[model samples]
Target chain A: MSIERLFIANRGEIAVRIIRAAKELGITTIQAYSEGDADMLAVKLADESVCIGPAKATESYLNINGVVAAAIEKSADAVHPGYGFLSESPEFARAIEQAGIKFVGPSADTIERMGDKVAARQAAEAAGVPVVPGSKGRIESVDEAVEVAAKVGYPVMVKAAAGGGGKGIRIAENEDELRTLAPQAQQEAAAAFGDGGLYVERSVKSPRHIEVQIVGDGKKAVHFYERECSLQRRRQKVWEEAGADCLDDQTRENLCMAAVALAESVNYRGAGTLEYLYEESTNEFFFIEMNTRIQVEHPVTEMITGFDLVQEMIRVCGGESLSVSQDQVKKSGHAIEVRLNAEDPFMQFLPWPGKVERLKIPEGEGIRFDHFMYEGYQIPPFYDSLIGKLIVHGKDRTDAISKMATALESLEINGLKTTVPLHKALAKDPGVASGDFHTQWLEPWLEAGNLTPENT
Target chain B: MAQVLSPLPGTFYMKPSPEAALYKNPGDPVAVGDTIGLIEVMKTFIEVKAEFAGTFSAYLAVDGVPVTAGQALAELVV
Candidate 1:
């Protein structure tokens, strides 16, 4: 099947990234955007663009019917949802398929199966993959949740079974907290995911978040090693690195194989991530969840493996086989990515949307900035605060850290406050540099070391 | 004083109970914590309360219309 024109059903740097990849493949690109994003870099960079809907994301980006209409109107052969928004939405995937355009990710059924955390956990368990002890199914009542918690033991996590993003999740140390927190969590989950279904799981305190990147063509799968995304705040990832330095050979191989096994078990296609929680003391890893689309931190994997993952994804969608086998793929130097959001880390990380007054970017060997900012681009408040990602790759962790520090120094955006200073401090921290970090690393580092700019 | 506003984002409904009469109407007296309506977003219903004592003016958002963060739901005559 020839992909004449591809419609990107998302925005930001990811849209631009997909457009560039399509251009390289000699395919015409059609960019879709809401009202506020018409002049975005992706729209300007693509061959053509269409206003999908109003500035409100629900009426626009997440408007499944509108996106399908845009794809149909543009005569696009395939629609690429570049992470977030409707990237993992099975309904959107089905709508694209119904509109006679190929959805550039996993099959719709696979998305549905992997979307619910409970079903996904069951699938992993059935496949012989170790999953954290939790509720066997969705808990419909607070009483049910309490019962499940007692069975699972204390210090359990209450998660919105239908949603993610750290929302609707509460860790209760005892039944009293569980009883109060459970209803609140359920309400929040219902508000966030449109499904109030809750589930219980064993909480892995001080565990490192490691995930393996895998690609499949429906018949076979290959692993691209793993990424360490231990640095996070409020359950959102901030800093990510590829080829975690702390892993020994045995553990690394085990994690990689486990990821591949899980992918094969489900007949997963395209790009997917199998997240795991690694306990340093026991060296045990348990499957957490499977993200059916390309992740926000895909660049780290690309840098370490020298692979254009987006291009590979498009090819896979176009009915091509996996390009590189397990043996052929290589993990090179250390790579790190720090998200540059238009928010002040000190001021509770509130979104600061404004025009870029003076933009000075970091430039040097092994440093790449993936952003859509210019001298006068207005950062819209309607969407996520992530303006760009600053990625640096080097021969080792030390080199990568030093290079990232230099890059952060060279970076300047005068109009809006950013987390650049926060990243800079994190890069220079002894614990971070040595890779002795956990999922709780970033928040405490900011609090204890006074990395917030105001503290200075 | 002017009424503050609803704290959460959702679909605004004027009546508390579907079978009961509306809570407040134009020129009706309201105080802080008085239930103005119900806002349902993603199946979660949150009561929209009057932030201050005032006379009800008009509903800014239509019934069952989805609202977002900080979008006005109603107005009041201080």
Candidate 2:
């Protein structure tokens, strides 16, 4: 590998994750942290550490110039931006490349293209990937709306071109309903935003969040299969599983191939994910967007495929070709990952950051807890609440869920409130075990007081 | 004289938003349950409400500065 020295441009558990991967690759890891994160675990684990800026992320982790300068000053050969912060910033990638340091992800151009919604949708369509059936643009008349609706199928959602907060929106189950609702929506929109322009889209009912993980060497690409992240609250994934059990073998093959096709079409480099909204009833998947960097749920994919994604991405971005091919990438058992956040799950998921007074992690095969916490560590309240992620692998989905439940029972972090009880309740939920949940399931479940003390 | 303590550990904001005016200025009257400031913890903005009615004296903690739980945020003349 050409990357002899790696600078980690992120913090928290992902920072620790990158350091470990870089160390295993025989590379010196330089951790970049804020003033408040001087005592973070990643700093201690890295071969060297530097403070980029203050506690505020806007002036620190998200500061491209500061991060780039720190990396260059440290004589780093490459920079690895873990998930969040500047991970998907094209400017950051370009700055690193211009500074004669490799960025452990896609090219700046690729990041910019994939970051755009319209551009990415066009790319997906050009690559023969199915996108959510919708109007080409704003429909001027009810006739145009109906024409678009017939092709996209029913039920359809009529939305205002300039609308927010659920205003000027209506759902129609059939043509008759569309005929009635479209004009009403148009009038409402015109009255509200003074723009009667409307658009129609095939409303995906009870959609499940599925994404395929793909890696490329900017020449060829391959997929590591799919992950189901349907369990979400406030649109943030709470629990994720690899090799979505909801998909059949044929559907899984098609979904994975479609992702690889999209990745190859863009000449994508390093790790990327193609998020799709899948409808269970029709077994149809619609491409939504692409994440240009590694994700929080990446470890679940790693657990099932036994592929070190971080190391692989580093190798490829360091001017090396993909070390593994499509056929060589094989997935074994099912794996589930639950995010452990520093929040009081019972109290409206309020953020609770405090010193770690005691720590006890579950230990056994098929169990992995990726975290940056240690005894006496004080978790700073300046960043996101994600403290750790608990992952488990098993022979199948049921077995994985069982292992997760047992692991949650043994895992303990004292002197701080966390979402442990939330995961414990989910692990035992019959709806979760039967895979009968959707992307909108968790919030309503919480609203129904399902995460009570007795449930945990 | 009394002090209004922070209910949580985080960055304290005297205003609702960057462009907004201060919730209470020095010498402003403060009533029970009136919002005095906001404490942003882990990206969640929680309102810091006054528990004791008094005349607002001065802010003990600087705006947009980090503060620990029970830290005096503002002084009040009872």
Candidate 3:
């Protein structure tokens, strides 16, 4: 099971990170890119590269056959799908395995189970994990939704059962909003995930978003503590930090155990994040969902634990057992990560893609920048605007914030607007610094400043 | 500019499922709304229309091939 050549079915900083990790393990890396990304960092860093298709994500990144053909053409022994795109698709994983190439993630059945929100909920409930009160299956029409909402009580969260990135979720205050928003949510979910399944849950107000990172080998598993990702805009995480400050020791232990139990129940392998909504008042945390791939904020956990998660994932794919026991896991210091996007934060966060004429990255002891940019690199008009991530780790949250502030001040990229100003403002906010924030913290704060429209 | 248009993301069907005539062929003068090809995604069939008045140039992806989003199903000489 010694992998010699590996094909990366992704692009950007995470792809670059995976390439480096593969190179470290004496595995030749083949980087796959879309048309605009042919000259990107991952292409330059890998031992080989291939342009799968044009710049549009659906053709290049999400195309199952195209990615499989690239791996087969390169004669790669394994394929590592970094976060986003087809990372969590069970069909893609099955295709790679059918092509006689090892997929550097979990089993197809495991992915299939965890991918369906209802099935995953059943698994969680079966494992005795605390889950939010919600419907057990997809609601087809408005009547079913109303009936479920009535039983679940008022102020329920209507979610696209097959959705992610907060795209198709609606918070309904009454029966009318639920009925009105259901069709729109279904259409969006159909367009995005190709599934229009809907579900209901009692909306947990003012809960801090906490998730536990776990690495398993289909046999043994261990938890890597928790990350408090309450600082989010539009359900997309803007900032993340390791060792959630609000969690007491008992709560942290319980949360970690819940994550482990959930993983063990499904025999999940590689890196996955078990998300939960933690209510500080009751010290109760309920299982939300599990991301079946490497997370965007994985670097924060890696910073605290001193483990190369990408490399470990590769090793697990090659049939390696769990490298560390539960007792060996330790959370040290603090790390904060911000996604640097080529976006106009003032213009409702619209995509601002162009060329980077001048780029200056930060340099300091605790500042780490994961980016795919250089001077004169064209910020392509296609794909996600996340050009990089600025991750700063320190001995404490205050020190991490100060380092991130300094790093943001020093970092510069011209020829396109970015979310740098927004991150800078967030870092300086007292509420964010004190960790006295909830899931709905960012919108109201930004609206009060007139930074965005009220609905935004 | 000769705008080369193609099908959006969908499954490609060439010969109307072995019972009907082929949609179009090379050198066919197609109007804007002419049915040049059929693409399906998630069990829904959508006709690939020529965005502008053009002559169908070539078929880039073969019939029955699963075309992804932004894939070139056919080249159009506008």
Clashing pairs in 1: none
Lowest lDDT 10-mer window, candidate 1 chain B?
A: B1-10
lDDT, model 2: 0.94
**Tens digits of per-residue lDDT for model 2 on A1-456?**
599999999999999999999989999999999988999999999999999998889899999999999998999999999999999999999999999999999999999999999999999999999999999889989989999999999999999988777778999999999999999999999999999999899999999999999999999998999999999999999999998999999999999999999999999999999999999999999999999999999999999999999999999999899999899989999999999999999889999998999999999999999999999999999999999999999999999999999999999899999999999999999999999989989999999888899989
- TM-score chain B for all models: 0.81, 0.96, 0.79
lDDT of each: 0.85, 0.94, 0.84
DockQ of 3: 0.05
Q: Taking the tens digit of each residue's C-alpha lDDT, what string does model 3 give over A1-456?
A: 778999999988899899989999999999999875788988989999998997557788999999999899999999999998889999999999999999999998899999998799889988888888878778878789889999877688888988688978989889999989888888888898998899888887799999999999988889999999998887889999998989999889989998898899888889999999987776778898999899989999988888888898899888889888899988789999999887788877766666799988889787888888888887655566688899999999898898898899899899888888898888777888888998988889878883432222
Q: For candidate 2, give the lDDT of residue A72.
A: 87
Q: CA lDDT of A292 in candidate 1? A: 95
Lowest-scoring 10 consecutive residues by lDDT in candidate 2 chain B?
B2-11
Quote the lDDT for A243 in model 1.
Answer: 86
- lDDT for each residue of candidate 1 in A295-379, tens digit (9 for 90 to 100): 8899999999999899888888888888889998898899999999887777666556667999998888888889888889877
DockQ of each: 0.08, 0.84, 0.05
Query: In terms of TM-score, which candidate is strongest?
Result: 2
Off by over 4 Å in 1: A134-203, A454-456, B1-78
Instruction: Name the 10 consecutive residues with the lowest summed lDDT in model 2 chain A.
Output: A159-168
